[model samples]
Target: MRSPTARTAPPTRTPLATGWGTRVLVVLAAGGVAVLVLPLVALLAATPWRDLPALVADPAVLQALRLSLLTAGSATLVALVLGVPLAWLLARDDLRGAWLLRALVTVPLVLPPVVGGVALLLLLGRRGLLGSSLDAWFGLTVPFTSVAVVLAQVFVALPFLVLSVEGALRGADRRRALVAQTLGASPAYVLRRVTLPAVAPGVAAGAALCFTRALGEFGATVTFAGSFPGTTRTMPLAVYLAMDSAPEQAVAMSVLLLGLSVAVLVVMRGRWVGGLPGARPPRSGQDAR
Candidate 1:
């Protein structure tokens, strides 16, 4: 054929470097996932399946479990009632020393739970400053009571709810809420109708976290609540008690607590992971781009 047709060059790849980079990232991610997953797997594998029913049915275990749920639930409710308003104030108000107040609010987060318990005892114990007045006037004692258990858990967990809700409130568009208010909606109406919907996921996440933290509250409960069975004792208390005479029992209780913790985390992940699509990710790397 007369004139040779021009030869076409093969399409070139984007680059081998890009492919290698992706491979390295995937491998690193896989390793990180493995590191986190293996411990949970080991705990499940080591669980005493045969003894689970017996351990669960044990009266002491049952009592502790019941108390744990009751106190943790109560604490979460308390946090919701008090912490939500506090979060609103932190986010929306222009109060003086607001930053200082926020720092104070999170003090419990850094303070040791045992230290928190001791502080509570100092402020609310039988011989405590207010405790003395409470005893003299009302003949009331908080230490070693079921109420004390709830109080301890709330003290340690309230900050989690407050901080979560406050962050959510801050991130949400205030303009939308203001628009609702300008459209003849009352402040309360705008908050209930416009603001709360935007922050529901954060509230859910905070509650889940508070519940989990309260469930595992051992140091404070032991120090202030005294681990009284059917009264102040909770799942963590049961585990500690079982550690001495029945090591198997201790391990069994540990497995139970572990399971409960994992369940809470799973529920939190499912409920809050992608619930607020408009909300920003906690870290820059989490951004989808």
Candidate 2:
């Protein structure tokens, strides 16, 4: 008889209940969701739905809404203009002190908005470090103006754009860009035709995030720009003012903001912000080889 064939036992999977690490992860995840979701639920439940339309229709609210959108849009555009190049440098270049540059770029993310506003005021106030010179030379004033609102929003929103675009650049396969350059494409042409397309998803996500952040900015705008109707008083500042004098209007505005956030997330889902990656084509049943 032939030698008996050797046999091996199949591998076994540990059940979830048997894994303390998995149990801890599940608990943590549950807690995180609860902490985030509960507040939103409470806010929605307390919303004054019956009078929302009228509240939002107030002239004061409308003025704030227009100013907010305008400033946020301007800020987002500025972020894109500056952040894309910075992102490319961060991802692809080997400049000296790159780490320091990145740290500086990201500082606003962790810095308190009020602190950032203070710093801006020191830099741009009429009698401030740069502002004094500007005032003396150009007769320009930045602080407590509409321009100040845009500046504050740009300061806070720029990091989001740079980080997102840099990550996308790092993740993208560089072979295509290299090949384009080798094929005599100019650097600008290559960036526009090859690099940007590869990272469009990240760019879109970054822009959305940047715009939303600018829209919601309060502390920096309040401090640096001041709440002047038809000038620097954006929606957040309006909401703050309303909360003190017109709680119902404040609730309505808050509800509107919540709705906008939800809508953005919903519309932006898939490839850009998140959801799922594209699926590969199904394999053929048979291979000739």
Candidate 2 lDDT, 168-283, residue by residue in tens: 88777799999999999999999999998988877877888888899999999999999999999999998999888998899889888777766775687554553112322223
lDDT of each: 0.85, 0.86
Model 2 TM-score, 2 decimals: 0.87
Query: Which ranges of candidate 1 are over 4 A from the true structure?
Result: 1-39, 274-289
Over 4 Å off, model 2: 1-20, 274-289
Model 1, 77-159: lDDT tens digits are: 99999998898899867778899989999999999899989999999997897998999999999999999999999999999
Clashing pairs in 1: none
> How many clashing residue pairs appear in each of the predictions shown?
0, 0
Q: Could you tell me the TM-score of candidate 1?
A: 0.82
TM-score on alpha carbons, each prediction: 0.82, 0.87
